[model samples]
Target: MQIEIKSLLKSCGVTSIMVTHDQEEALSMADRIVVLNKGRIEQIDTPDALYDAPASLFVNGFIGHANFLKGRTSPQPGTIALDAGCALALAGTAPPPAHRDVMVSIRPENLALVSDAQPRSIAVTIRVVMPLGAFSVIDCVTASGEAIKVSQSRAAWSGRPGDAAWLMIQDISKVHVFEATTASPSIARA
Candidate 1:
């Protein structure tokens, strides 16, 4: 379907502006991604940047699966103490709002299964496991009931449901922190 649209655009010599609710469709069709929320433009950037470095929490959750972690800000500098026993170091130097509720967005693919040799291993219990063609997704919950989804290799887990797994976030640097949005002003991102 995407190839057909691209071919049509090329043949007609027309620049098309396609609006789609599906994020994959938008990523495949548009050269520049425009993310709109509630009839307002939230972000306009390249596809890679839009996905990797989302402007806000709505953009991050819309582009990919985001695990919202509750955390607090550190007094010293660019550091956050996250729930589920993790301390996140922020890339930006500015201090976050102190004593306020914060959420961190981390992509599923960035979380990797780790062995004992790895440094950053966090324990989680598998609630459910669903196998796609290329990758297997493990639905897990931390000890504190914060749900986490990790996309791992098909061969990573051999057991059925109710198994324990430890994952070491391979790309911690990719995690982003954003101010939480409320229901007063609903925002949609695509």
Candidate 2:
């Protein structure tokens, strides 16, 4: 019905603007999306662009499920030292200013549960697990009380609540960095 309506509108040369709170609906229906935060425009882009390259923390969090870690940029390019003593190094994007406080944003699906602690891995305790048929949503908490969610195939993870695991970023290119301030700026767009 939605597709048929969109097609009919397009055939009639009619332009329409839809205001929806459903992220999936907006992503699927709109040609371009204007993400607003507190009535202020945060980003304006296509659905794919908005999802893949959000312009700010608000946009990133609004578009999809994201895990935010407080950190500061390292002296080395593309590295961020998390407050929890973990460090993240992005592979493809430009690094943020050294020593500048920043927040790292990564989608739940981008994180993987690993048995061994790797170079950029963070230790988290599995708090809850929700099995959703094909996949499971694992809720974890860092030692510092920071909560993170990881989505993976049901067969991939077998950890129960209270089990310790390492959270590893699957791809450095998928990381997003934003300034850790009220007037935050996006350092890594995509």
Number of the top candidate by TM-score? 2
What overall lDDT goes with each candidate model? Answer: 0.73, 0.85
The deviation in Å at residue 1 for candidate 2 is 3.5
Off by over 4 Å in 2: 10-13, 183-190
Those runs of model 1 whose alpha carbons end farther than 4 Å from true positions after fitting are 91-98, 115-120, 183-190
Tens digits of per-residue lDDT for model 2, 20-116:
8889888878889898877889899999999888887778878867888889998999888888668887877776689898988888999999767
Q: In candidate 2, which residue pairs get closer than 3 Å at backbone N, Cα or C atoms, i.e. clash?
A: none
Residue-wise C-alpha lDDT for candidate 1, range 1-190, written one tens digit per residue: 7899888898999997887888888887888988887778989998889998888777887886776666777674667776666666666435367665577777788886543424445667778879997788888887767788888788865545777767676676687877555631123433
Clash number for each model: 0, 0
Model 1 residue 36 lDDT? 83
